[model samples]
Target: MYHAESFAAMGWETYIVGYKGAKLIPSLLQVPHVRELYLPQPPAFIANLPRLLFLLWAPYKILFQALTVLSTLLGELPYAPEFILVQNPPSIPTLALVQLCARLTGSKLVIDWHNLGYSILALRLGASNPVVGLAKMFEKTFGRKAYAHLFVTHAMKGVLVRDWKLLGIKAVLHDRPPSHFHACEPTEIHDLFSRLDLRPAGEDFLPPSSPPLSTPFTRLRDLPPSSLSPAFAATLPDRREDRPALVVSSTSWTADEDFAVLLNAMAFYEKRARAVNSPPKENPQKGDKHDRLPKMLVIVTGKGPLREKFTQDIDECQKLWQWVRCVPMWLEAADYPLLLGSADLGVSLHLSSSKLDLPMKIVDMFGCGLPVCALGFDCLSELVGEGNGRVFKDAGGLAAECETVLKGFPHAPELEKLKQGLVLQKSPTAGEKWNTWAEEWDRVVKPIVTHRPGVE
Candidate 1:
């Protein structure tokens, strides 16, 4: 969606071809002037069948899907497109077929490599499997055929050059959130919370009773409600003026993320909070407030296979800690930005599939001015640093970091410094960055599209 919008902003006509799935939010289809071609999708049961069974049927499925994509391009496009950009991962037969179609149409093929197909297969089927070896050869052969390549990180580019010997006009194109996500107003946060039922009516759970932070951007409340997804919504605490410190984490509920580590850290934080807030029985004081200890609400978003188990674990932990609230949710696309804006801090447990790709979620969090506590990765320092957040090696380290942030909340000077650091972090607007990228893309493909003698 970001790429499509960026190209559209540059006055280029754009079209998106993708599968129709439950996770595809309808609002995305509303991007102005951009046509969409949705391929038929198999039923959920078939798509989610046992790994072996799904693999057995994959070849035929891929052929049918590829043919459908090719036919759609031929029939719907008034003329052959000058360029075709395709995402990779399930690259095996898809990229190969797309390359064939691009050749037939005289379009320049640009492969955006997100992850190697063989690496994904190896992760699931074991690195030593014979099929994994075959997949590596298949991906390499087609991957190098692209007219140009776009990588999400420099680390990925280095790996491809070193490991696969892929050479072409390649550059890093980091993911970024839309400008609207950068600075949101308090009323907009409140209104979104109300519409999403993120907080029950009459409840007062807003952050500490201080003036809302100010930013240079326009307030979201002035925008129409039609911009938000009407289908699904999640609740948050209602009272912004006195709400607990907000810690938010979004996950895909897969093995790549060790949710157990986060759960353990939360448990440790609860234990420490209990110890600190325990009453001094010897000097019984009168008229003491019942809830003097600072509280925290940890909202974990995203749905996946491990969601149920992790939610149960969180529920069990919450039973013992009154001051800690853990809410697990699945959010629609529109609600995501508002949710991030409402958070005081972000936590990410993503163990990258490749050290090269950075977490898009963290980028969005930074756009919202939310500091992060991310699990360390080889290239994480490029995004996270002293002011914005910390990197942790284990549950113990993560727990300690969480404690430090929580203990310093509600006017701690150290927490204020972290906020200042978050504000200082800057990058070019998505439009400027994408426009520069589009220029590079044009340079790489113009000759190929115009000077090629004939279609292969």
Candidate 2:
């Protein structure tokens, strides 16, 4: 699946060789310029056995079938490929054969590492499992031999570059592309709300008074049609031409999201405004003084094991929502934009784990024209810069920076910059990046291509 997206975007003549003739049809080979190699299904008598037992035997059966593929490739495929991109998990023997073929054909070998196969094995089996050691050995050997490696995160890169020291292996990193969002327009937002049956709001966080158009407002509410709907967008405070809101939103938890830092910063700003005797946004007392602050909304979108890990701090936020005004765990992604667009700031948070690749939603935030407050994690810092977003040092230091963003929120300035740069449609650039990398790939593989003979 990773290859289908990355290789095709890079303009490679990609092919997927696998079994299942009729069953694999379009779904298996739909990517551009990609072809599939398939084999006939087993006889009906063999197919009707208990599912689990068959599933257990699947790998061995696939190993046997792979031998046939090897013979067919050697005899039928007219030319040897310049590179062989193979994934693990199907059949070890088949992958070993593919590796052998790459060596014999002198094609540069590449491994699309999705995760630590050995680590997963250890989790499923006991730590003392003999197979775990063997699996690690195999992975290490493959990592050493592969001409280049592709990992989804910097954590993976650190393993290869820092730990494995696999010099010359071009570690290409990637994340899932942004969900397809039509260009945002006022009417698009309106149409979205209408489709969802959400009425325009006057001034409240809750949906409009009318019954919703959509029943289960789960992931759909995160889409433009629902989020940008006239009702929701209308509720946002009128934009201030001089200063913009600095909103920070994420699906990551408090520990990962660095919510405490943001809260502290907001408090600091509020205190500073009071010290200067700034007038409050609302009714002020004889002694009461408050700054007419840019409203900030920190939206946390996803939940589960990651959220549970930070229960203490999360509870604090839940309690502090009255003062901090945070919206944790939105029903949909569109809900975030609807909440964030009117918001003066946008923040995306991710764990600073060496294993995490990059957060995909951060790109979505950029696409929404919200300048980011991103964690200075591996690829994320490089992926987004001063222009597109601000990467913080860590969760601890994020509060001071959050305060800075609030004080100098580029509500209007940044909006103009986003419109000028068209940063929202940032994803299509990945396709372009892939194309450039493909050209580099050709250069990297050309020497091997010239040395190898056509398969006979």
- Scored by CA lDDT, what does every candidate get? 0.69, 0.49
For candidate 2, which ten residues in a row score worst on lDDT?
211-220
Per-model TM-score on C-alpha atoms:
0.80, 0.50
Residue 26 lDDT (model 1): 40
TM-score, cand. 1 vs. native: 0.80
lDDT score, residue 395, model 1? Answer: 84
lDDT of 2 by residue, 350-442 (tens): 643333456656655554555666667555654567666667765545544555545434333443554344353344554533222234334
Model 1: colliding residue pairs: 198-235, 198-236, 204-239, 205-238, 205-239, 205-243, 206-239, 206-240, 206-243, 207-240
Model 1 lDDT, residue 336, Cα:
85
Model 2, residue 254: distance off in Å is 11
Error of 2 at 185 (Å): 2.2
Model number with the top TM-score: 1
- Please identify model 2 stretches exceeding 4 Å from their true place: 6-109, 113-139, 151-183, 190-248, 251-291, 308-316, 319-323, 330-345, 355-358, 377-381, 394-397, 406-456
